[model samples]
Target: MENLKDEQQNHHQPVKIDLSGSSFWAKKGLKSLEANGARVDVYWDFRQAKFSNFPEPSSGFYVSLVSQNATILTIGDLKNEALKRTKKNPSATEAALVSKQEHVHGKRVFYTRTAFGGGESRQENEVVIETSLSGPSDPEMWITVDGVPAIRIMNLNWRFRGNEVVTVSDGVSLEIFWDVHDWLFETSGSSSGLFVFKPKAGFESKSLSFNGRYGDGEGEDHDVEDDDSSPKYCHVLYAVKV
Candidate 1:
């Protein structure tokens, strides 16, 4: 396993990280949450964030904090070369329009509902800020908001919005939901119920235990194997003081 120092040093490079999509979102979302409370800034590894097991480009979300109530934002590939077409040629059929931009923690988060190909409907990357106001950290969530097969949220105690459901995969399963505004601990059951996440003081710092599912880049297959599985895995994030 690579040391934390090494990981921190080369975080910009596309390293094989085993973080879940929701976790990535949570960490990034903290920027917005923190912004609501204090000064904050956020940065994401665009190059690595675009690397996924599926297709070619990677799709995901990341957040940053700039102030106690201000956040800078950018989604995976939202600012990439792909979206240049939309800026130049704005078309209802060819380009996506802003779905909505609401103020979360004083920052305006812009979400765009876009359709690609013919019936292949999906949400395009959203943007929240221009320049980063904070540094970078490991992702808390990394699932494609609109382009995956499945994700299973075994236990979720938080409230959520967007596409809030799990999609089954051939070999792996993904779960993307917030613990509402709480933390989750010691709960497991069916794949068909609202599993609430309760809060704990140090749950975030408590080392994660993926059981046997995690492999440290020593040659492990952690990519989605099938398409047409589940498309949306949405979760909402809220800040709770420690």
Candidate 2:
């Protein structure tokens, strides 16, 4: 966020971003999939990523595009300090980010609208790119820009990793296996409210009439938590499948 117009995607703040071709994030396990004909990249743009809130409501936290071994890119404080709006950058996140539009699908994912930036600059919302993750694997993440599908991670075998996380994706579809045995039931009061992204599925991608409508900022204010522990809050996911 330091220089919005910079060509390189580097946020030179406490939370740094790696723009070098050799990204800090690891893609070791992903090679086999590549051998099987899947695309590869040094860094990954985490779709609809969430961060654990800092102690101070204003002082925010950071999230990274990390692999099993290293960190790739990290966005410092996803919110705008001056306007209290979400931060967005297409070149950094590798998604064509647009503002004031709805459901820009595929690689053209929408980040939050630039509420308090310089001029009234909002990326066009008509372009679409072909971006996908590996297939035949569990889902690592399910991300959407506005109401349009963005990126999804697959084959992320975190079951044995043992950190209370489960993510998998396959470029096209996504599946998530959660192991919050410790985070849920055992805990209370904002216990399960550590995540943001509100997920709701439509009837089907083909049938707009029956696929339901996607409202703007529908899930923006979800789990509004200041911290992750010692508080009282419960997170709920409203997903509708047809």
Candidate 3:
């Protein structure tokens, strides 16, 4: 019983992260995006992103359909990325959260049960992107993108070693391999997030990709456009050197 108690205490203990070596995201196309409509582009890869001080804190990305605003969710640790944090204190009566559990560190981790409520009908324009974040059904991480159905995600979880890959498809599949195992298990290094999505099938041909790039000279202004010529600022790139 004493040993079990010790383990439980450790489970709830705050994760001491070397703030200097944290993993977060900043894509490479924000310059062009912000110029276009007060746009806010954020990228976060939860595969390696750490959340401190919460039992089963849902860390991923989230989007508001009404406003078309999107942001990544984490435990509030990032070296170079803008932290969009929202705290929810739901009273049991108004509880939108249900109970589900996962065991990560020998302790059971609880997750929220959520049913992405329905719209009156399908929106004229709809987009979906699978982050493969593997959080509670009540996804805290939601974003805009498009894809048909399921695709084999062998490289995403990578045996729970933190080698993850996120792929999106308009039927034109784009994959983002979050290359990080050292940072996830080692010291406090950082990781990047890639957000990709396309408009609903046939509704629009254009696709969107956000690459959160980091490293040396991480803050220098850079531009990202589609592969085609003409500098048609179709995609937004955001790179943050944390």
Candidate 4:
């Protein structure tokens, strides 16, 4: 887990509870900790968790973050289990997933999933990135969402760094920025591509920042008051060729 930081810029070290290994106490439990002047209760059970290519579990487990007798954040598919163990009702305002970073390794294709929108309208969408860097044909790339091709870049050599706005639902859209210069120009085998996905709205006042040339563009920075009506979320994926 990453460190928790509040809006006041105070950093709180995360408490780690190992749920792995053969130890009998490592499977399920509840932990109480204090952070930023608040009591946080963590309830988790991973005895029958399932995983995929990622290190995080994919299903069959529950990790709930409770505070003030309310569940704020819940992971995995066992929400009901978490509620039962925590003995707390879901918070009126659930925690927002502000940002996520994932590293995926593949040769020419990379896959991931992310949820867009918030509240009742939120929906998960599958993202598939396919690249053709070498062959008789010119280098090209295709980005698909929910098994549908959403964005296609032809002649990737000239368009290696670009941004596109893709529509995910009727009234939901996201801005995608990609930088693959390292994959094309760098001779190092450790080269990887960067892709950023952010919702079209809510991020106007405070957008995700990147360290590369993509950060040098105009309108990347905004100074405005924070709006609770529109929550911000961002997903960053690093595709490493292997």
**Which candidate wins on lDDT?**
4
Q: Model 3: runs farther than 4 Å from truth?
A: 1-147, 150-152, 157-191, 196-231, 234-242
**Ranking 2 against 4 by TM-score, winner:** 4
What TM-score against the true fold does each predicted structure earn?
Answer: 0.17, 0.17, 0.22, 0.62
Candidate ordering by lDDT (highest first): 4, 1, 2, 3
Q: CA shift at 206, candidate 1, in angstroms?
A: 18
Which numbered prediction scores highest in TM-score against the true structure? 4
Candidate achieving higher lDDT, 1 or 3? 1
User: What overall lDDT goes with each candidate model?
Assistant: 0.26, 0.26, 0.25, 0.69
Stretches of model 2 off by over 4 angstroms after superposition: 1-143, 149-185, 193-242
Candidate 1 residue 90 C-alpha distance from true site, Å: 27
Better of 1 and 4 by TM-score: 4
In model 3, state the lDDT of residue 220: 31
Instruction: Tell me how many clashing residue pairs each candidate has.
Output: 46, 20, 24, 0
lDDT-best of 3 and 4: 4
